[model samples]
Target: MELLKTLPAKEVIYSFSTLNPPVLHIRPGDTVAIETYDCFKNQIQSADQEVAAIDWNEINPATGPIFIEGAEYGDLLKVTIDELEIGTQGVMVTGPELGVMGHRLEQMESKIIPIKDGKAIFNERLHLPLNPMIGVIGVAPEGKPVSCGTPGPHGGNMDTKLITKGATLYFPVFTEGALFALGDFHAAMGDGEVSVSGIEVPGRATVTFDVIKGKHSKFPILQNSDGFAMLVSAMTLDEAVKTAVEETIDLLLPYTDMSVSEITMLMSAAGETQISQVVDPLVTVRFFVPQHVLDSLDIQLFS
Candidate 1:
């Protein structure tokens, strides 16, 4: 019912949010455009900005401190990435490094993806479809040194495409300001984010925003506009799967008249869990809980 403070930017800052509030006192279904840039942070001015060659210091700059009016500690920011755009016409990939799953970042060598006639041309050989995503999206770690490649439950660098437009992410607020910062926006990526990188492109984004107070979850919960609710993570492959399953059990228990034992029994049938990556060190696991079930459950009470 309240319109809150909004921010739009193009680079990184120390603490994006100063208050770390729980909810961004706002209504659902509201849409807004978010600006972003290439992950190189402009530090690597040329395509020579090779992998393992990047300074890491001058990469992945996030924009803004969109202060959520009533957000407080312990609440979840349910952000829906409504739209993603490569505001400009540029795409680059440096050398490929080791393969996460099968995509290397070192030997990959950076090449320019030229946009001609409104389409991105790949390698002058093959055309890669564009699917932009924020490589790094998260709230303030308070004083932690969260990097550009690591995504945690706080929603740092999950690197998954599911966080794209229409995917609602529930991130926990650690600091008072929640200090949300999002950057390293990629033009496109795959399952394990296995490519150490994707069609790295520059662009701005638009997101629908809202917040929930009371309780929270252990990982980013995504409700696709498609009628499915999924839990995401960046934990070790095995750990990520375990956590997702655990989260499912909890999500299911409350709605069913079933006891813990009964809930556990239904887990193998009522829904499904699967590993999105087995190579990214930080894996991506998704627990698909039907939207019908999620619709009946209370997001705030889960916290």
Candidate 2:
């Protein structure tokens, strides 16, 4: 295993682009411990800090564009999140013109939540269990540079709460070495990220990387104990949901004897169309299919 620590002065990127040089190189099957800054780059340390004081340029700083030896174009870069270690304090921010309810009357506010014994102390009356997840994670895109705040086929800030420990995320390798990087740790977040922020915190993610030659998904695929989910992002929630359903059907078609209509019906019956986060530049959605459903059909997603 190799460790890539992110010191305060360490270089972090706001976008996922081939233009960015790789900070570290490793072969397939290697476990890397990547340290990361919070979504706000740890600038909002106290509740008294105003959200407007933050440098908008450093909204989401991903740790590294780590180069994987065997990853290449058209291949799949498989990343298994082995573990996540977050800091003691997490921050949440909100204000007018910020999130889903931003238009409502509200001034800028920042909250510093303390983490203790695996729970986030939301307030004096409520303690929520921590569900630490990686908010920004991706490889370089095939096209132009993409902001770290957006989620797309190349994965960026998907903000899916499911991307926690024990989950395996597969990203399409667009460039050689699959220049991958990640940051924006959320100690706890809900679906849709309705407030534009989670319990944002600095953390370290331990992950194992492997290259799956040739085969890759149209979008990223997240696999966890429950099942497999197709991660898709688009300009709008409707578009994202439509694309996710279409891609999910495409993925299942080849593995089953069922016709498109039958598969569509099956999906409607059992699959779940869930939201990741709507606050990003591009909204992300996931179409999930349970393991039991696949098992019943004798279908295996990947060889």
Best by TM-score: 2
CA displacement after TM-score superposition, residue 88 of candidate 2 (Å):
0.4
Error of 2 at 56 (Å): 1.9
Tell me the deviation in Å of residue 136 in model 2.
0.2
Instruction: List TM-score per model, in order.
Output: 0.77, 0.96
> What lDDT score goes with residue 293 in model 2?
91
For model 1, the stretches where C-alpha displacement exceeds 4 angstroms are 1-9, 14-32, 42-55, 88-97, 101-108, 115-119, 228-235, 261-266, 274-281, 292-303
TM-score of 1: 0.77
**Shift in Å, residue 83, candidate 1:** 2.3
The count of residue-pair clashes in candidate 2 stands at: 0
- In candidate 2 the C-alpha lDDT for residue 146 amounts to 94
Estimate, for each residue in 237-299, the C-alpha lDDT of model 2 and write its tens digit: 899999999999999999989999999999999999999998988899999999999889888
Candidate 1: RMSD to truth: 4.6
Tell me the whole-model lDDT of each prediction, alpha carbons only.
Answer: 0.61, 0.91
